[model samples]
Target chain A: MIPAPVIAAFHPPRRTLLGPGPSDVSPQVLAAQSKPIIGHLDPLFVGMMDEVKALLQYAFQTRNEMTLAISAPGSAGMEACFVNLVEPGEKVIVCRNGVFGDRMRQNVERCGGIAVTVDHAWGEPVDPAAVAAALAAHPDARFLAFVHAETSTGALSDAKALCALAKQHQCLSIVDAVTSLGGVELRVDEWGIDAIYSGSQKCLSCVPGLAPVSFSAAAVAKIKQRKTPVQSWFLDQSLVMSYWSGGAKRAYHHTAPVNALYALHEALRMLANEGLEQAWARHKAMHLLLRNGLDALGVQFVVAEPYRLPQLNTVYIPPGIDDVAVRSRLLQQYNLEIGAGLGDFAGKAWRIGLMGYGARQENIALCLHALQQELSVVI
Target chain B: MIPAPVIAAFHPPRRTLLGPGPSDVSPQVLAAQSKPIIGHLDPLFVGMMDEVKALLQYAFQTRNEMTLAISAPGSAGMEACFVNLVEPGEKVIVCRNGVFGDRMRQNVERCGGIAVTVDHAWGEPVDPAAVAAALAAHPDARFLAFVHAETSTGALSDAKALCALAKQHQCLSIVDAVTSLGGVELRVDEWGIDAIYSGSQKCLSCVPGLAPVSFSAAAVAKIKQRKTPVQSWFLDQSLVMSYWSGGAKRAYHHTAPVNALYALHEALRMLANEGLEQAWARHKAMHLLLRNGLDALGVQFVVAEPYRLPQLNTVYIPPGIDDVAVRSRLLQQYNLEIGAGLGDFAGKAWRIGLMGYGARQENIALCLHALQQELSVVI
Candidate 1:
């Protein structure tokens, strides 16, 4: 037997999360997680699960009965949509503008679907014209998948346009709203999204782990038409829905992450209380605050103004600035965390986030002042 | 667009968790989850991630380098092992004695692996002799999978012997340690377990949603030699290891469940401090306490004493007793949760769990008293 290693209790220091995700969680949501855990199948827990489903529908602006939280993060939720809706040998057209867009192509291929890529440069939105062209070319494509907001580049694609194109082509739409959900204007029903997934930590002011997802009636129809069972037993939406969908009886799926759901419930409750439109407006206001300050500091944005995501701001590092050193110092000295550029943008840009509870005047002012002092020292 | 649903914040009433899983979490572990949220990629959070790996190693008693927690629940962890190591068309021997064991068969089938079943009665332990016979019968089988502790039936199969039989047959062993990890004697290295997956909610006294998994070098070699990519992108261990493995640079895979991981780390730390042997002994001691009390109440155990698990005790519902009424009243009136029988045992048995923090003298006393009163009323 290996001797037990004595480890101390992990006590994390307070950090101001201005990074791409896991933005500052409200104390209410955080405290909710510590509340006593109940059985996943308990009558009370089942009641709460119903509320969660209704609230998620509101958050996504959809009336889809298939709305529920996946037991894992956004990635698993993304996989759930693909594995359930897309069969082997099926064709899927994926828009690749950033890291998550590329990930969508991977999900397609992993599940034995053929993926045709529609490429866009980082820091730019998925071009609707290019999507239209791709859809026209791949008329047999069963699905069109893309990221609504590219977290890696702070680019906001026109989801409404993309979904409309998918509809015109008679293909189901799969959208990754991981970084978009509560921070901007997104209506799953109105925009005609077939299947969509979002993270709990990104714009919900909840801790990471749970992924909120919804599927339109069309998406459910596609899943039901599949001749083969879903490839992933854990992510099989048909089985998972038996537990999350309010049926006469709840069957045992995997044990739901009880405490994490508590946090998500509190986060969604707060979002509804604040109202979705108001939250989106607040995110835009905070982005403007940070944007003006960055302009005064001589830092340029990576994305064009009209295409940018208010919650995720990508800006170029000042010439001759050490990317790692600046981020390190900010973390150590100011207890502030900003995201280093990801994928194609690595080491060339920085991502500052204004999400959920973190989208406040105080957070924006602190971030602007910190960058000003750091850049001056480097110069 | 769906209107926002005005839902109040969920405040779960304090309940003593004694069900099959999601056992009573320690206040310390619960409080750790509520600590200020940190960035998933934060330097400090990464440091804590290292501690979690080490603490998990102690809990599983394995020195395997492939140890890490899946961001989802144990079901995902189970799928991770199968999708990574079990290639399409490969033959695998699965010992089916309970729900989890049958689930393992489903995983193998979903991955396109042929599963050879070795059947056992629901309440009985997996007979090693039968496993050996199955292994000999299926010489081309590349893997042997079974549940270490069957949560559905409270049957404790001899994992060490089963793993040895697999080794003798030139087959790798995969174990479901969901209910066994911290509560029973599990030595992943000594027993030659090629792959193992466990749950946080079962015996770690942590919140549900994270699955701790480890792979032996042979298992890693099998994964590396896979002719085809893992079917599920989200559960793919090779890509996931790039983010989890202790390498010079951590790659971003998915957002780590930040707060949920904190709870896991704290739970594991407490396990290490208590010492694994001591925890095992305590579970045994508490099991005997509950066993004697149940006997005095004329309750008979589902599994024989030799094969029964200490953490989870399955007892046949006394004749003339109503299964749902007793469990419902226990949940609604006493706020004490005991599991209803699962699978074949449904409506005939009750699973009373004395797992992790819930394995206490007080819990045993209350459960016996409540069952006694309820049984008399039914009579």
Candidate 2:
């Protein structure tokens, strides 16, 4: 028998989260998560789930009945959209500009579907003309997949134009709104996105576990007409729909994450109270404040202004600045947390976030001041 | 433009959770979950994750370095074990006695493996002799899968004996200890369990959504030598290991459920403080007290005494008693929650759980008194 190891109680530091995702969670949401545990099939909990779905629809600006939360993280939600929509031997036009787009390609390949890539620069939005060309070249492509707001590069692609192009080519669109939903202008119904997925921790400011997802009628019909069963049982949307659908009696899927759902409900409720458009405006306003301050510190953004995401701001590290040392000092002295660059831009860029509850004037001021202090010491 | 829907704040009712799973969580664990949200890749959070791994290792009674918590629920953990270990066209002997065992067959087939069944009666332990016979008949079997504690039927199988039989047949064993890990005796290393998965909501008294899993070196070797990639990308263990392994620089596999991990750390730490054997004894003693009180109320158990699990107790519904009415009344009047029968035994039995923090003398007394009062009203 293995002996028990001595461990201390985990007291997390009070951090001002300015990361790409998992931004500051509100106290109301955290307290909601601490509510007493209940059974997954409890009647009262089911009622709360219904409210969560309605709130998610409000956030995504869609009236689709199939909108609900997946019981895993955003990556699982991304996989759920691809594996359910694309069948074996089918072609999918996947636009690749940042990390999540490449992840979509991996999902397509794993599901035995061929991914036809439309490549662009890392910090640039996906080009609608290139996507149209790919769809034109591959007429048999059944789906088009792209990230609306790329978390890795802070680039905001034109989801509306891309979805329009997919519709023109008789293809369904799957949008990754992991960093876009509730932080920017996203109208799933207006943009004609057939399927989409977003994370709870990103713009929702909920404890990070659940992934909110939605599907239009076209996507549901495709799932129903699939020739083979989905390769994943846990991620099968058909089975999951029966459990989340409104009814007096719901069939049991896997056990729902009870407390996590509570947190999401509270988070979405707070968002609805604040209003989605107002939340977007707040993010943009905070971004401008941070931007002006960073510009004074000689920090230049990687993405061009028009295409940059207001929630996630990727900026180049100042020349001769020690990335590790400055970040460590900021964390140690100022209790500030900022994101490091991901993928190809590692050590060259830093991602500063103004998402959900983190998009406040106070948080922005502290982040800027902390960076100034840390840079002064390092340089 | 879509208008934001007005939603009320979610205020969950106080419930005394005594269900099949998601037993009553402790206040400490709940408060731990309410701690300020931190970045998943934060150095401090990484240090806490290391402690969580160590605590899980102590609870699982194994020194397997691959032990860590999955970012999703227990069903995902089950899928992870099967998808990672069983390759396409491989043969697995699945011992089916209850719901989770059938779920195992589904997971195996979804992973492109053939499941050869070794059937036993529900509410009874898995027949080790039958597993041996199946393994002997199918010499090409690569794995044996079964549940250590069947939550659906309240049956406790002999995990040590089952693992021994699998080892004798030169096959790896995948054990589901979801309801058994903290409440009973589980020596994974000594029992030779190759791969095991459990949930946080069961005997650990943690909130739902996280799954703790451990894999022996032999299981790791099998996954390493697999010919085909695992079908589910989110459930892949090899990619997850790099993030959970002890190191200064951990790869980013996925953004973990940060607050949920905090709850698990606290739950496991409580278990360590109480000592595993002491916990097992407490569960057994509480079960006996509940059994006597239930007997006075003329309740009959579904599973026989020897094979019955202490955490989950399945009892036959009294003649002329309405299952739904009684359970609904208990929840409405007493704020108590118990589980209804699932699958084959629906409406015929009630599952009364005495797991973790709920396995107390006071809870047992309250459950007995509440049931007696409700039965009197119904009759």
Candidate 3:
């Protein structure tokens, strides 16, 4: 028998999280999460879910009726899109510019689909020309999967152009907007994006866990025509559709993370209150503000200005500085949290996020001050 | 284009959730959820995760090193165990007694495993003798999967006896403890349950969405010898092991639902404080109290007394009463939520849950008072 460890209740310090994702959550959203517990199937909660769907459509700028939050994180959302649309033995042209793209390939393979990859350098956006080449090479490919905003590298690819390429090739486009949705300009219906998924923690600034996803009519038709049932029952959109849709008389698919959805609803409400364009502009403006300060500190950005994502800012750690020490001191001394680079860039770069509630003047000033103090000790 | 619908901020009523699951979460757990968001990879957060693991081990009453909470609901947790352990073309002996047991069959098939089902009546527990017969008939079966407590029918099965049957037949046991965990007597190591999954929203009294699961060392060994990669990248425990295990230097798996985890940590801590057996006895005592009151109201239990679940109390809706009307009145007029019968029992029964914090005297009295008033109008 394992004895229960004598541990005190955990009280997490309120660190200023300026990481790659889970940037900063507002107290408003946090409070909504803490509000009295309600049933997932409660009619009132269902009404709130309807509002959540409408608000999500507004954020995504889509008219797709098949839009709702996946009950898990963005990774599950990515899997949902792939498993539903990419059936076994079907070829998918996956574009890999960073970590999430590689993950997409893994999703395709796990779903028994062959992934024909088009590789690009990390910290660089997906090139439409390279994708066009891939599509031409694999003429039978059914789906074109790519990440719009690579959280690993802070690079924002041209999603509109990429979707057009997929359309030209008669391929459904499955896009990962996990870090792009509210912070960047995304037009799902306008750009004819077939399927897309994003996270609540990134630009939405909700507590992490839920993933908002949208599927176009064409994508839904493909799902209905699937030769095999979606491999993962939990991620199957066809079954989940009955639960998240169907107005008030929805069937029980899975017990939703109810309180987490409450937080997401409030986060989306706040996103709507600040117009979509306004939120994107704020993210861009904050990115500029942070960049100006970093320039003075001689910090170089990993992604070029034209391709950089406003919500996520990746920069090279200085030659003389210790990566973990600077980050450790920032956290211990100033209650700050910034992301370490992932995958290929691990230990070499720092990803500083200026996401939804975190894109503010005060946060920028604090991050700059903390970095300067820590870096000066070594420089 | 779907124009953004202008909706007011949602304020969910402080509901007394007496449903099959998603029982009323305590104010303390709710308050913990609303605390400041932390980075998933932060040192402090990682420290808290270790505590969560220890607390979960104590809650499961096991020293299984492969114990952790899945980022999604219990369904995903069920999927995780199946996908990791049951390889393609393997035969699993699945027992169908209620809704979840059927879901397990679906999970088994989705994992490319053939399911040999042993059927029992919905309100009846899995007969150990019947399970033993199935094992004797299917000597080549690699696993036996069954529900420890049928949430749909409020029937508690003999997990210890059934696990012993599986052991005698050289098969691993996969048990669904979604409604049984803290509300009943469950000793994972002692019972020799190879794999088990439970929901947080039930007896744990936490908010819905996270699923706590544990796998014995034998089960882990089976997973290690699997031929195919787990069908789901997100649910792949092999990869998730590096993230939840490995002490301070845990690898990044997914952007964890950081805030939801804060709530789980607190819920587990509360369970540890209360003592597991004490929680079980309290549930039994509360069940008896509700049963006496329910009897006076002429309510009839669906499950036999010997097999009834203390946490979930399923009863037939009195004849000649509109099932929808009574439940609707209870929710609308009295701000109470009780579960409607699901699957085979839909429109024919009512499931009055006394789960977790909702199992107390005040909640029992309130539920009983509300039920009497609603039934009086019809009777």
Candidate 4:
């Protein structure tokens, strides 16, 4: 609405996205991003939604009947899962190692649920034995929540074992695969994950708008039996299903991000063509290439090798090297985007991502070369 | 991740968006919708954000500063305003005549604020006398909230009067201009509206992902003085302001819907070129044409003419007519989109909208002709 006379320059940098997310978007995906906006209930857009659901099912290795993208980001996805499953006064065992886990605790407490948190060091995997001990101690806990890949520290948790432990304790399993889906192995159904959420910006290489989520039959059944209604109308899946499900008469929910779904559909199609397992291998291979370059430059990873996420590699900034200065130079000079460490690790480490379409050898080399130049100037 | 073999069709209907919103998008806007994705904080993208803020200020008719779009839809905008302004135990005087006003009451209670509601009849304009009485009754009320153009009932309330009442009573005002703004006359500065929220899909004719919002200086001051943190980290405007304000070192917020902003910019540009007064005239002109057609066809309006919205027209479904049957036929046969009545008025009315780019003489004729044909079959 500003006068056209005052319209400023909208020159976006053509940077190589090598951060936790969003990964570099493919041209095809980017083209899809700008598809004409359509009504959410338009037959064609609904078809696209149906396709996205199927693609997400394949990506998560799940046959769960309920699957769709929430219209907001990954945090909304986290909120959706908890608000639907955790009723007031319920006990939820939250596994905390990084920022996202702490977010889970916040969500639980906000919903009036008691969070029985099992803490682990940041940059370390969730301790399955400790989870088992907690489950043993608190048999009444209704759900076990954990992040599959903690973007904050680049650590991958034992999602399968954690789900198993939740099942043993008769608790539902909620997993945050925001930075893991398609980049790593995520067998939602096979691993017995009851409810899961993922971000489009990460391994999907789509713009960050929609959050793909799935609820297992058991999870749905639990929701159906809930004594209290979902507190947040925006995040309520019960009302959401009437709109997202396969039905003759779809109900009105909040409007969906129509064009963003087109981009997501394209990205998921690209992932489907490459195959999930092959994509995971590609991410792992590129991570190794980036790690080798960083190691050769005398950089140390914040997360230990065994549990490091291929998509996000967290590296410690050497003593006396300015974290902000190195990142600024990377952006200003090389047009390379990388993430700063979050929360406790802020100013101490850098997060370099090799994810989805960005997991190519060329991008890895470019990122490393840029980082080396920037680090040398700063150090 | 669906099998690459299952390719879905991307069919988009050319809807003459005559309902509540998701108005007809222009070819230029549609083309902008398809722009390539970029990092949210990319210099160019940040520049766009600044332009968008300026444009939003123009559309809202306000220059009080702190205007930006929340990444989610208009409902989220409502959430952002209430969550930031109304902390636990504060009192808010909400005037409820239709769905959005009821939603405001719900949000106030959910945010732990005491909601003092002034109820008006469905399909009727919010009564200023009732609002003034409520304000007088609840002298300690922190804010007054109401919908400017009620999408449910197609009633345009006296926003200027409401805001004046709020100011006189020493309380701020929250306005839902979702179906107003580009479609009708709104002067945030003249009206003294404190916090206003609108939808991208409505009069703006942009895709539905972002919610345009603006905070007055008084509202921002109230936010800063709040004792508790905004419950929603993603919607906390204090953090969001850093990313939206075109400062030298913009802080990193969540990744915005990058490509959607392109479409919005283009839409706003189109609006600017047309001029606000001209656009309002066009909407009124088209509405008059459509109203003539409806009156000729013996269709009575749900909302009385004097208080009715020029953009959205709510009409009673003739007795013995099936509302769903008529709408379904219109969708299948003419590919036209119109909205059904919401909340208490459901099954009684149909909402026909004439908004933004959708408010064309040709589109109005097409919608009227389509409705007449559908009605003959049902009636």
> How well is each residue in A1-379 modelled by candidate 1, as lDDT tens digits?
7887767777788888999998999998888889999999988899999998989999999999999999999998899899999999999999999999899999999889999999999998999999999999998999999999999999999999999999999999999999999999999999999999999989998999989999999999989999999989999999999999746499999899999998888999999998999999999998998999999988999999999899999999999999999999999988899999998889999999999999989888778888888999655
Tens digits of lDDT, candidate 3, A49-94: 9889989999999989999999999999999999899989999999
Clashes (backbone N, CA, C under 3 Å), per candidate, total 0, 0, 0, 8
**lDDT (Cα, 0-100) at A12 in candidate 4:** 60
Error of 4 at B54 (Å): 2.0
- Measured against the true two-chain complex, the DockQ scores of the candidates, in the order shown, are 0.88, 0.82, 0.81, 0.41
Pairs of colliding residues, candidate 3: none
Runs of candidate 2 with Cα error greater than 4 angstroms are A377-379, B377-379
Please name the candidate that would achieve the greatest DockQ relative to the true structure: 1
Model 2, B34-53: lDDT tens digits are 99988988999999999999
List lDDT for all candidates, in order. 0.92, 0.92, 0.92, 0.85
**How high is each candidate's interface RMSD, in Å?**
1.0, 0.9, 1.3, 3.2
Report the C-alpha lDDT of model 3 over B113-149, residue by residue, as the tens digit. 9999999989999998888999999999999999999
For residues B1-379, could you state the per-residue lDDT of candidate 1 as single tens digits?
Answer: 5678888878889898888998999899999989998888887788889889999988989999999999999999999999999999999999999999999999999999999999999999999999999988889999999999999999999999999999999999999999999999999998999999999998898999999999999999999999999988888898899988745488999999999999999999889888999999999999999999888888899999898899999999999887898888998889999998999999999899999999989999899898888988654
Clashes of 1: 0
Worst 10 residues of 1 chain B by lDDT: B242-251
True C-alpha contacts between chains kept, each model in order: 0.95, 0.78, 0.87, 0.36
**Model 4 regions lying over 4 Å from their true place:** A1-5, A9-11, A137-140, A225-227, A318-322, A372-379, B1-5, B227-229, B317-326, B344-347, B369-379
